[model samples]
Target chain A: MKISNKKQTLAFLKKHFIMQLATSYKDKPAVAVMLYAVDNNFNIYFATHKDSQKSQNLLKNPNASLSIWEHHSALIQASGVVSVVKDAKEQSKIMDRLADAATEDESFWPPVFRIKGDEYIIFKISLSWARILDLEQDTIRQKDTPFTELNFK
Target chain B: MSETKKALIILNDSDPVLGRVCKNKFKKQAGWDTILSSTYDEAIKIIVQKKPGFLITDIILKNSVKDGLDLLKFIRESDDKDIAKMPVIVFTDLGQEPDKKRAFDLGANEYLVKTELRIADVIKRIEKFIS
Candidate 1:
């Protein structure tokens, strides 16, 4: 598929449920595989326990990067400032979106929902910049630059 | 009669007029009922009991040991998931970057500087979230 524009990018994001999130604090970096939801504005949302390393890192430093990829098909790399979505209404909305994006198997449920005692914090990554690599189209070899930059700022 | 959602306003006693005006404006413009609290402790109690649909609070509270930021932290850390996740808007006179950062860091949904924005602008910002 020709994922060139904002609409196409949003479509691509909505089709995927999992992403690799990268966070850092005090020169130390950490990455976690997370189930995420993307909104119309292309902001990414995910929930993690407050005590988790990524959450601790984000609390101290909100800057982060994330990537979503499919085997030999396409790749999206983006970075943004993360903020906790504290509003109850907004949190519920994001959870609904996440539920929709979850795997289709009826018996499967994300582990985030199964954990009972830990408090989960919903974080929003308001994308400042993004780029797409359309491998199926082989734009990298044919074009001068492989990355099609997306501007959300 | 149709049910009206409630918006809790946490303010200090220094300016009763501001709180009253905001209450009336929110009610008239957004059709939301208003609940007012004067301190962090009072706000927390009202939050647990009333479960208001929205919250607007000031950073400083007169005659109260704890201020709005403490209240915000409490709400975000509440054992009850619903209260912990409740929408909170910090409407205050503190416009400094550090203060704003602190509020957002503590999980405030919106931070409005009282001196920077007009009352109408504040109401509009609140309506955007609740509406």
Candidate 2:
């Protein structure tokens, strides 16, 4: 999807809290639903159980992808390169930001989600490119709104 | 009520990133406050000042004026009762058999290879000692 404005894209990405993370290793592909927060540079951050299959796969192969969407409106597919956030101070800062984002729903934020220990790992997904599937436009306008490479701030 | 336990992580200043990560993990997962000592002298000073309940160290500390093994020996042989008896866990990339045996012989309560160490496993081991 080609959007003429980058600000509009940023708004769309920030509006969603969940993303479907897709990763593959040695011909096996896995997808997991993850809660993510986007940063100013469009980097996505998420935490996962350290021993989970997705975490293991990412550890083996950092190349991955993420998808976010709403049923009636649009879908955004973005490619990502994963890296572990190993710094304590940086992890604290990111967790605080995430907690602030989920303030409206405290139940969703807990000690488990906090980057406090080894049971979980914090991941930073550096987005390479993204494409939007404008579902409403595809249905109403009667044309495929093809995927586009995201080069926006 | 018992006082809170403190854990100290000793690493090379050149690898501050790992130090920071370990410090965070100990604090967040085990509910322990942590202090970092990057060099041999700094480590000695912090140990004297904080008297940490738990200690974690890497085998090879590049910035350390004295090696990690030396510190382990110092702690075990210290005249101070608390310092001499503190539980120590050695977390390092040195996986050679001799290195492992040496750390264990030097009175390290636990030894972990950084390449194979899992944060969860480390936390569990720490909880066992510090809890």
- Per-candidate iRMSD: 18.2, 10.0
Off by over 4 Å in 2: A1-153, B1-4
Please give, for residues A50-98, the per-residue lDDT of candidate 2 as tens digits.
8778899999999999888887667788887999999988876676555
TM-score per candidate? 0.51, 0.53
Task: Provide chain B TM-scores across all predictions.
Answer: 0.92, 0.92
Which portions of model 1 miss their true places by more than 4 Å? A103-108, A113-117, A138-143, B1-131
| Each prediction's whole-model lDDT (CA) | 0.80, 0.75
State the displacement of the C-alpha of residue A110, model 2, in Å, after optimal TM-score superposition: 22
Question: In terms of lDDT, which candidate is strongest?
Answer: 1
| C-alpha lDDT of candidate 1 relative to the true structure | 0.80
lDDT by residue for model 2 (B16-131), tens: 53555565555555567778887778888999988988788877777666788899999999999999999989888788999999999999999988667566677776677865
Best by TM-score: 2
On the 0 to 100 scale, the lDDT of residue A39 in model 1 is: 86
DockQ numbers for every candidate? Answer: 0.02, 0.03
